[model samples]
Structures are given as C-alpha cells and as structure tokens.
Target: MKNVEPKVPLAVAGSSGFLPGCEGMRGAAALGVLLTHVAFQTGSVTESFWGRVWGRFDLAVALFFALSGFLLWRQHARAARGLSASPSTGRYLRHRIVRIMPAYIVVVCAVLLLLHEARGASATVWWANLTLMQVFVPYSLVEGLTQMWSLSVELAFYLLLPLFGWGLWRLRGEAARWRVPVIVTIAVLSLAWKYIPVPTADGVHHDNWLPGYLSWFAAGMILAEFATAPPPRMVRLARIPMLMPIVAVCAIGIAASPLAGPPGLVDLEPLEYAVKILCGAVMGYALLAPIVLAEPGRHHRILASPTALMLGRWSYALFLWHVAVLMVTFPILGVPQFSGYMFPVLVLTVVLSVAVASVSYALVEEPARRALLRWETARAERYRRQNGNAETATAATVTKASA
Candidate 1:
C-alpha cells in the first residue's frame, strides 16, 4: 500500500508548528479549576450568579482530559495515517510517568504530612493517595487531596492509551474507515456506563472513576483524528467565523443552569449527570477546536505569549498544589470555612499556589523530565549501535557464504 501523507494544517503539524494556544488553554483550565475550588470553599458557589458560573468551571477537568487525549494520541493518529512511525510503548510510558509522577508524588507526600486532618491517616490511605489509587478505594480520599480523583482517572487513561494506540495501528485499508466511528461508539458507551446500577457504599463515588469521563477524553481524541486528516466538513466548520467559540459559550451557559444539576456536593440524577457530561464534552471540544483547526492568528498569538506559555508550563504543578494551598489559606487567614471571603481567599490562594507551583516546576518537574529524556536518548543510541553491529556481521557472513 502506498503511504499517504496526511494533510495536517501547518499550525498543528510538526513539533515546531504545534499549537501555542494549547499552552494558553492549559493555563486557563488550571486557573478555572483553582477558581472553582475557591468558590466552593468560600460558599460562593451556592450564594451568587458568578459563583454558579465558577462552579461550572469544573468543566476545566474535561478540558484537561480532552487536551490529554489530543496531545497524547496525535502520534498514534499520525502513525495510523502513515505520516510517522508509531511511538515506542516503553518510551511513551516512561515519558508519561516522568511527566506527572515526580511533582505529583512530592505534593502528595507534602499534603499528607503537613495537613492536620491527614496526620492520623492509615497506611492504606497513604498508599492510595501516593499511587493515585484513592478513587478505587472507598473512604481513601484525604481532606486536602480530595481533588486527586481526576488525576487518578488521568493516570488510568495514560496506562490504557498505548493499548488503544496499538488497536489503532491494526487498522488497514477499509478497516481504517471505521476508526472514528469506533471511537465514537466507545465514547457513547462510556457515557452510558453512568447509568449502570452501582450501589453506593461508604465514601464510594463511582462518578470519580474514568468511565464517567472517557467521553471528554474521546472528544479530544476525535479532534486529534480530525486534525491528522481533516474531512471536508471539518475544514468547512473550522473556517466558519466564531462558530466554535459561540457554541462553547452557549454550552457553558446551559451547564451553569439547573439543567446540568446543582453545584457542589449534591447528588445528581442520571439524566442530570448525562446532561453535565454531554455539556462538558461539547464545551471542551468547542474551546479546543479552533486551536487545533484554524490558522495562526491573533487569538493564537495571545495564547502563545510568554506569560501564557509560562502559566501553561507550570499548569500541572499549579493543579497539584492549589487545593492544598486553598485548604491552608482558610487557617492562615483566620477565616472559617464557608465564611464569606470569596475574593480574598481566591486572591491569596492563587498567589501562594502560583509561587509554590513555580518552585515545583523549576526544581522538581522540569529537572526530572529532562533527566529521563536524556536517559531515553542514550538508551536509544545504544540500541541503534548494537543493531548496526549485528546487521554488519550478518552481511559479512552472507557475503562469505556467497563467495
């Protein structure tokens, strides 16, 4: 079969041409998550209109999942389309582990050791949180680390992605046409998983698991597929001025309404949960589509700016630390939980979280990533040299036999 080059847009093609706006979106998503947590803690989520809007900012988690799906799956998509070689599963897993675990483990340890409520936690609790397995066990979520369920779900997806990529790699000829449809079916089934009867147990929250949110990730994966070889319809849609942003805003507005269910800790009905899931997927996709599809422009430039890039670079650490910072802020400021100081608490938390996150990124995350990448490079070079020598010896033997 002839290898066909995918017609990827220049804005999102090679490494140098990757979308800068995605960095901005990541920064924005991190801020959204922090803001929502602050609103909930300050009792603003239940008190005011803006608070409700802030509450819906948990949609940022969907955005994070979507971004992960797109960015991580792109290589697989390219490989499926014959644009590039498939990524090595070992190297991919190594990169994913190094990218997330160093800073994550540091924050998990710090939170468990430092937080008053976590001081008396059992070893099981420590093990669960450290391994990002808190969501699997009932009652394992520590106070300051309650937000890590999403991270656990993310880790699950990371472990599962290589298998999914292998499946994609198996598509050949006409079978490749089913790729998008198959992914869409999986997304639908994942959403339907929410309706399956699972009895509630002490501290068990089924919604926190990966199944409930796979659709959001699938949305990004679908976009990744589209980006690799955009269909005529997608190209047309991307060219439509302001279409995606408008859809994103409208989805958000609907999500903010009662239709998507009450904010905070209230249990939602099945229908409400489905609505929230659909809205989140739509909103996240809408927000990200333009960045992936459109040509470079003012919006991209703004998002690609130095400040936004820095925020994006620090976004993961910021996410890991914000909830902990928010938890400590109430005590340090002498404000009671749910006491009405939303603005002040938000300000303080943002300031402290950013400071801590910057240090974590600089001293922990970046260094670990660089060190592992260097190791991977060295390992690859050694493998190449060994393979080269083996090939040379085999050729010599063949020549001698022919003589």
Candidate 2:
C-alpha cells in the first residue's frame, strides 16, 4: 500500500461521526477566550493571583487554531478530489469570505461607533480598523477593543488556507507521498518561525518575537494532516492517559493568575509564560485527540449535549459579534463595578454570544456554505454529463463516418 493510505484517517470524509468531545472543546475554547477578553478589558491583570490565572486563558487562541486545522483538513481532503472543483480554490475563498464577513462587519462597525463616542476618533481610524489592516499597518487600535489582533491573525490564516491546502493537495503523488510532504511542510514552517526574517513594522526581524503565532497555525495544519493517518498508540494515549490531566492543569493554572493591579506581589512572568505555553499546547492536543482518534462516544456529555452543539455550531458568529453587543449593551445598563458580582457579566456575554451566533449562522454562514455546495455540486454534475455525452457522441459519429 502507498504511504498515503496509512495517513488517511479511517473515518470517511465530512464525517459527522466526530467524537462530541471536539464539540465540547470548541465551546470550552470559546469560553476560555471570553474569559481572557474580560480579563484584558478590565485591566485587572495585577489585581490578584486569580486575575493572573484568568489572564492565561488567552491561550485558547492556540486551541482554536488547532481545532480549526483538524476539521478543515478532515473535510477538504474528502471533498477536494473532483475535476469540477479545479480544486475550486476560488469557491473556497469566496465561501470563507462570505461566511466570516457579515457578522464581522457588524461587530467591527459597532465597536468603531462606540469608540467614536468614547474617544472622538476620526473616520480614518474607523476605516482602518474596519478593514482589519490597522493591525498590520502599525496603527494602534482603540485600547479597549484591541483584542482584534487575534481576529487579524485568524483572517490572515483564512486568506492563505486554500492556497496552502492546494499545495498540500498537489503533493499527493505516488512517489514522495503525503506523509513526507506533510512532515516537511510542518518542519519548514516551524523552522521558518525559528529562523526566517518575517516582516514586521521595523521591516526586518525573525518571527520568534511578538506572538509570531503563525508557527502554531502550522503546527495545527500538521496535526490535521496526521489525523488522517492510521491511529498510533500515542493518539490513543492522548485522550486517556495524557489529555485529561493536562487540561485540568491548564484550567487550574489560568485560574490562579491574578488580574493586573498592585494586589499582586512580584510578577510570575518567568514561570507564567512557561506553564501557559507548555500546558496550553498540551491541552489543545488533549482536546483534539478524542475528536481525531478516539471512538465516537458522548464522553464529553456536558459538551456533547444538544445545547452545546448548537453553541459550538454557531460559536464563531457568537464570538465575532458578542464583543460589540456587550460593549453597546453593558454601559447602557450601568454595569456595576467589577467585584465578586462579575459573574453576571459573564452570563450576559454568553447569552449575547449565543444569540448573535444563532442569528449569524442561520442567516449568514450556513446559507453561504449551502450556496457553495450547491454551486459546486451543479458544476460537477455538468462536467460529468458533458464528458459522458462527448464519449457517446464520438462513438456514434465515428460509426456513421466509418459506414
């Protein structure tokens, strides 16, 4: 058998049979990001040790990348094999743009409008922020809602994925095989981060500085490719012996970091970054392993439950739209000072996230996905029919001519 065969996960393409644990992981990661957002917004980082811990939930950004990588690869590998598709990179790009834009536009505009009042910013600032280029162009966004950086990175990844996916798809020849290509690509991207002079505002520097977080995305893509491989013992070990404790430790670790303020003693930066990066990556693995490797069971019952699935399904919309919603609604309600009662803010965040997400997915992302499938499916059918007719017509015409 070819080396590529073993790399393909036994699960059929677009398998809804995913271990629900993955759905749980999505919700959990989204919530983790929400926590980090709240912590960042409050500038409560030094307020206490707990604040510090909550601060680290920001690592959910990594978890989000990893999970997206696994699923996108899983689906694309199964679907990208038809002539009509031309691999349909154009369609893929369109779908991504449409799926993400409506809600994103709404949210970015809402934030800008709020900022307009709060800081009297000019339309130029609004224009740059709305376009998502500010983060790359060296303009600092409004301080309060600058969490858009992660969104910027995610948008950048979305832009490159079809091209990246196409390149990897082309490597699926008989000789070099998928495994070599995947491993090589992963190693190269990772090493580039370690060595390449990635562009920055300063114009020349390696990716090792700042959150040159692209390496993690490449890691995620690598994981996605490998998920198709035959199950290894390590894959099983991840969910059982490995993943559980790792997630617990990460949760506890973030829970302990204090918010920013004088209430904190000396900073834990030395040990803090260490624990978060290490544990965060591990937690990301644990979250993904079950979905990628384990037998489908409602093992994460809390997550696999119907409500969570709905939330998970629309989580992206929910996340993109929630910040603006919260910003608009919270102040109007005269939100009380943060303290032990802060849980209410979290509740509002979840509710609004869920509401916005449900609307966005039903009206926007889902319809956009359906449109792509319909267009592509029709195009594929046409090509098949045209090819079959050409073959038959040639045979008939030749017989008459021969006669």
Candidate 3:
C-alpha cells in the first residue's frame, strides 16, 4: 500500500458513460453523510445549522442508493449495443466483492488501530463490521463508526444486483423497446409512499426502510441501460426533466423533516420501503439526467468541470476515511465541547479526510482495482482464443471428410 499507480485503466473511465458529475454527486452525497455523522456525534452549533439547512446530511444516504442503481443501469443496455447479456452474472458479483471488501478491511483496521481510546470493545466491533451484518445484529460496531448502517445496506444491494437485473429483464424481455414504462411504474409507486409518516417506537425513530430505496436502483438500472446507448432527444431536452422531480423531492423531503426532536421532526420512517425506494429511483434519474437526456459534449462541459470533477473522483476514498478522522477527533475535542468548537472540527475533518483519501486512492484501492481488472480481462481473452481454436479444428475435420 505505497503510492502505486493502476496497471490497467478502469473500464468505466473510457468505455462506460460514467461521466464526471455522477462521481461528484456520489462523493458529495457521501460527504453529506460524513457531515451528518459528525453532527450527530459531536453536536456543534454549526452542525446544528447544517442539520436544519438540509434536513440533516444523514438523509442523503438514501440518495446514494439511487445513485448506485443509476450507475449500474448501463450494464443492461447491451442489446441496444448489438450484444446480449454477459454469460456470467457471477463475474460481476466477484468484482463487487473485490472492489468493496479489500479497502474497507484495510481502512477499518487502520482507523481502529489509530483511535483505540475513542470507543470500547474494539475486538467485538471489528467482528460485527467484517460480516457487514452489524446493523441487523443489535450491537454497535467500530466505536463511534455509526455511519456503517448504509454501508451494510449497500453491500446487501450488491448481492442482489443479479436478481434485480433478472427481474427487470423478465418484466418486458431485456430486448423490448417498451420497458421504459415498466421502470416508471415501479418508480412512481415507491415515490408516492413517501407521504405516509414513519411509525414510532415508544415513538422513537428508525429511519431505515426497504421500499423507499428500491426505486433508486431500479431507476439506476434503467439509466445504466441508456449509458450504453443514450437517446438523442432525451439528452437535448431542457435541464434533465427526468432528474428535476427527484431533485425537487429530495429538497422537499429535507425541508419537511426535522432534527433533534422535541419529538424530532416527524420521521419519514413509517412509509413502507416502497416510497423511499421511489425517491432513490428518482435520484438515479438525476444522476443520469445530464447524460440520458443527451451525450455529454461542449454544451455539457460544465458537468465535468475540473474542480467538480476532482472532488467526484476523490469522493469514494474520502468517504472511506472520513468517519475514522471524526471519531479520533471527538475524543481530542471532548464531545461536550464539540458544540462550541464546531468550526475547527468541521475544517479538520474535511482536510484530513481528503488527505487520507487521496493517499488511499494512490495506495490501496486504485492499485488493487486495476490488478483485478487486468486479471479478469486476461482470463476472458484466453477463453475467446481457446474457443476460436476449437472451432477451427472442427472446420478442418469437415474439409477432410468431404475429400
């Protein structure tokens, strides 16, 4: 894990329609969650200010799910590209495991090792975290690393990607041109459910719900398809109409939700998993809006501007490192005093997280990421070569028999 470069370029960089803004939105969303965790734990006046300004950055985690779906949607757009679905969904799953687990294991260990005093029972927390089932398990994992719930959900989603794709494919036939309506219907149903308030525990809050998020991935998959062959008219339309509603909904959701309750702003928790899923679906829409409505070009250069683009690129690694910095920072600041010294902690967290993440990209995630891709591609090329050789041998036998 020194500063090593990728041996092979990532497929998405040149091949997929994974334009810069998507990464920016994801990283920005991840950062928003980071701020929310900082605010929830340290309780600074500035954090309070932020919580009110945007309904707590915590709510944005749901948006991440939507972004996930939108990004993956591209893999499905193959028939549109004159190719069928890949023969093995298993390969995609293995890549996901390889991509996520390795760096997470490395970073979590580093954080726990660095900040032992900030939390208790490090051994047990580490165990729960490894399973990615810590959230469901009742016990807390990783000291003050409370932001892991969303990570657990994301891991679960990765497991379900193939199932999701199969279900989507079966819905209208993967090759059907009319599948757009099917996606819209599922998305709309999920969105409408957001209106119903979440039920209370002793009247307490449990913000996690399943239905609310599916729509986001579903939407992501839909758009992922477009990434393969983005429509011309949709790309050229005014301001990404597909994305507008989702943006509007998220803004409204935050505006309506409250933090630090007298009874805490009525939690949107009760609505069945469907509505939030719908919101996520819409989020998928917004993430892909710039590209789906049109291929990015001279007019769309704003979406990929250098400053914004750099932030997006570093966004994922930044997310991995941020919480640990906050945890160790809190004990130094003393949690009680964090409220008054909010400005310093916020600046410190951002600076350290970014620095650590830049290092993470250079050292751990990127290098391993490239090696895995190179290995996979090489295996694939060999398979093709072997298959072609067998076909040639079969043709030779037929020629000899005819003579």
Q: Per-residue alpha-carbon lDDT of model 2 for 88-184, expressed as tens digits?
A: 6676677777767766776666666554433666676667667765565554456434556667677777777776666666555342236435644
Q: Which of the predicted structures, 2 or 3, would earn the higher lDDT when compared with the native? A: 3
lDDT of 3 by residue, 1-403 (tens): 6998665421222125456666666666777767666655554323244445433455467567766765555565564355455426777777778777877877766766666644345565678676666655555455545566677778877887676567666533444565566766765665555565656434222344344455656666666655554444444442544456567457435343342221112344434333434444444466456544443342235446776667677777777778887766766666553364666677778888888888887788788789899998999999999999999999999999999
**lDDT of residue 187 for candidate 3:** 58
Tell me the spans in candidate 2 whose CA falls farther than 4 Å from its real position: 1-19, 75-88, 113-127, 143-145, 162-211, 241-243, 247-279, 296-299, 336-341, 381-396
- Global lDDT for candidate 3? 0.60
lDDT of 1 by residue, 237-270 (tens): 8658899989988988888888888877677877
Candidate 2's TM-score reads 0.74
Q: Give candidate 3 regions above 4 Å deviation.
A: 1-16, 44-50, 77-87, 117-124, 171-178, 184-212, 225-284, 298-303, 331-338, 388-403
Kindly indicate the candidate among 1 and 3 with the higher TM-score.
Answer: 1
Each prediction's TM-score versus the true structure: 0.92, 0.74, 0.75
**lDDT of the candidates, in the order given:** 0.85, 0.59, 0.60
As a TM-score, model 3 comes out at 0.75
State the weakest 10-residue window (summed lDDT) of model 3: 256-265
